[model samples]
Target: MMTLRRKLTFLVALAAAIPVVIMIGLTLKAQENLVLQAKGELNLLMRTNLAHIARDIYALCDTVNDVVAKDLDMDLAAARRAMAKCGAPNLGVESADWDAVYPLTRQARRVPLAKFMLGDAWLGQSRDPAEHVPVVDEIGREADCVCSVFQLMNEKGDMIRVATTVLDETGRRAIGEVMPAVEEDGSPNEAIAAVLRGETFRGLATVITNRMFSVYAPTQDANGKIIGMLCVGKRPETIASIRKAISGIRIGKDGYVAVLGGKGRFRGSYLIAPKAEDEGRNLWDRTAKRPDGSEHHFIRSMVTNSVAGGGRAIHFEHYPWPKPGVTGAEIPEKTGACIYFAPWDWVICATLYEEDYHAAADKIESTMTSLAVTLSLAGLV
Candidate 1:
């Protein structure tokens, strides 16, 4: 057991092994530090992208909203008389039973058939109808967003799209459509309900083909009774220059930036994703099992934490799924940063796989193994 050659070989192997172990330990410590740093970077990336997206779209809506306050002044009585005489308000969609029954105490503020009687068809270009509404086209041109006027149909809180720069599915002017009193789910339509209460409703609302970041202001008569609603909005996805930038962001090797609608009807739905793989789908309803065998409602937790940040804070979450919006097939723990942009109800998220961040450690360990074998062979020689 104590042969001189065996003793010398053992001593040489031990010397090689000691430094390799020490070097590996040091590399691992450095890798751990790098990973912790990358997590912060991931979270920062989310907030930066979130702000980048929120700003431009918000500016578009605000600019149009501001221009409307000064330009849109309608005399409902004059509008109704002129329209009714000319057989206008002809493109109207019939409102729901809820609107027909809701007792709006200030129904007197509503001009008879006003919702059904559009003053003029302002279809992106100024054409003289019974009542001329040039602002719809003017503002739409100025800000490159949608502009429309919705006259209150009744005290039942129904509003009709009388003049609009908005186009229908077929690309013609979307006019005379009744803005319903409630959502398709029979729940109060938040934007419409807020306008009925004489407050500006600012969030996301449907503008023809998609939900847009929108602003809706109540038009009131001299007696302070709401007569109609002035609307302005733009699709966040089609926002002038930022959509491409937001969609192209990559947090790490496989990590990416994405957006989910955080409130109302769009809540639980994916607003942005790579290739639009699951856009318009509710991706937040499912629960997933984590790598640690714990049940996790990843999306719900991410959204709640982002909202809790109150628009100024950035929050991080450890999600255990490999893909965004999909449940099951747990990953090796992913970390993401999320922030809520309430204006459009978007939950902006940036995520990276935990293993990706520790790639340095893996590489170092691999290199150390090779180095250890080489050093031990040299010692044996």
Candidate 2:
């Protein structure tokens, strides 16, 4: 143990280990700094995307409000008569409802004499003018001007696509169709119901096949009774765009940013911005386990934190598991960050392998072993 060759070898091995340790320490520090920076960047991007989505929705609402304020002037009696006659052929309603509210058709129909509808006594038609056509046409013009979808619902909770950018499969106005507040999937649509209850409603909702950022306002009659609802909406493409923007971001060899539904029964279901294979898979209900064999409710945490923090990013750690096309082979432990987009009830997430940040440590350990082996062989010589 006291031999000069052994002493020299020990010193050489120590020298090699020292630098490797130091380099690894420096790298770990730098990697931590980079990770923090990336988190900030990711959070910023999430907020920016949310802001853009909000703006589009607000603009659509503003457009609707402006149009209604400028052009909506309906004479209740005349409107009922016109819409009733307009709907008579389809609804089999020989007359209006008991409350005298005209039952709207599921589809819009052409008024028999459009020229005489706008109080055009100049047309000299002895028949009473149809008031509904002018109001419906005005709503349509406003919708076209703003390039937003619009709908008008009678007080009886029957909605008609009077004038809208949204078209039906028939390429015609989605007239006469009963636009229920409930979704196609039978989900309760509280926002639409709120509008019917004479409250303003604004949020993300499905408009036809696509989800949209929308607003609904109650329209009042001359007597101040809430007669109908006016709605305007714009497609929320920003979410899709955000997904596209982040798709190329690499966290680790297999890590990525994904979007998930943030709230309610659909929580954890992939939406707008997830890989195609991941769509409709309910991660919240996933029975996956962590490396320690503990049940991991990763999606629940994402939703809870985002909601609690008011859309702020929540950082977490997880053991990587199989996701859609990704097999669980050699999957490393991961660090995840998520933020909520409340407008659409969506969560945006970023994840990276924890091992990636400590990769230099692995190299350092390997180097130390190699140096020790060489030192021992040299000492033997």
Candidate with the greatest TM-score versus the true structure: 1
* Best model number under lDDT: 1
Which residue ranges in model 1 land beyond 4 Å of their true spot? 1-143, 153-158, 176-190, 235-240, 291-294, 323-332, 365-381
Clashing pairs in 1: 89-118, 119-131
Q: Residue by residue across 236-355, what tens digits does model 1's lDDT show? A: 454424446667877666777777777655666777776666778787766777679878888888787777776676677776655655566655666666777665667777666766
lDDT of 2 by residue, 124-215 (tens): 11111233233333444444221221233433354543334455465644433345554433565566578667886655555554665556
* Predictions in order: lDDT: 0.61, 0.50
My TM-score estimates for the predictions, one after another, are 0.61, 0.54
Residue 126 of model 2: what lDDT? 18
Residue pairs clashing in model 2 are: 105-176, 106-175, 106-176, 106-177, 107-175, 107-176, 107-177, 108-175
Evaluate model 1: give its TM-score. 0.61
Model 1, residue 233: distance off in Å is 3.0
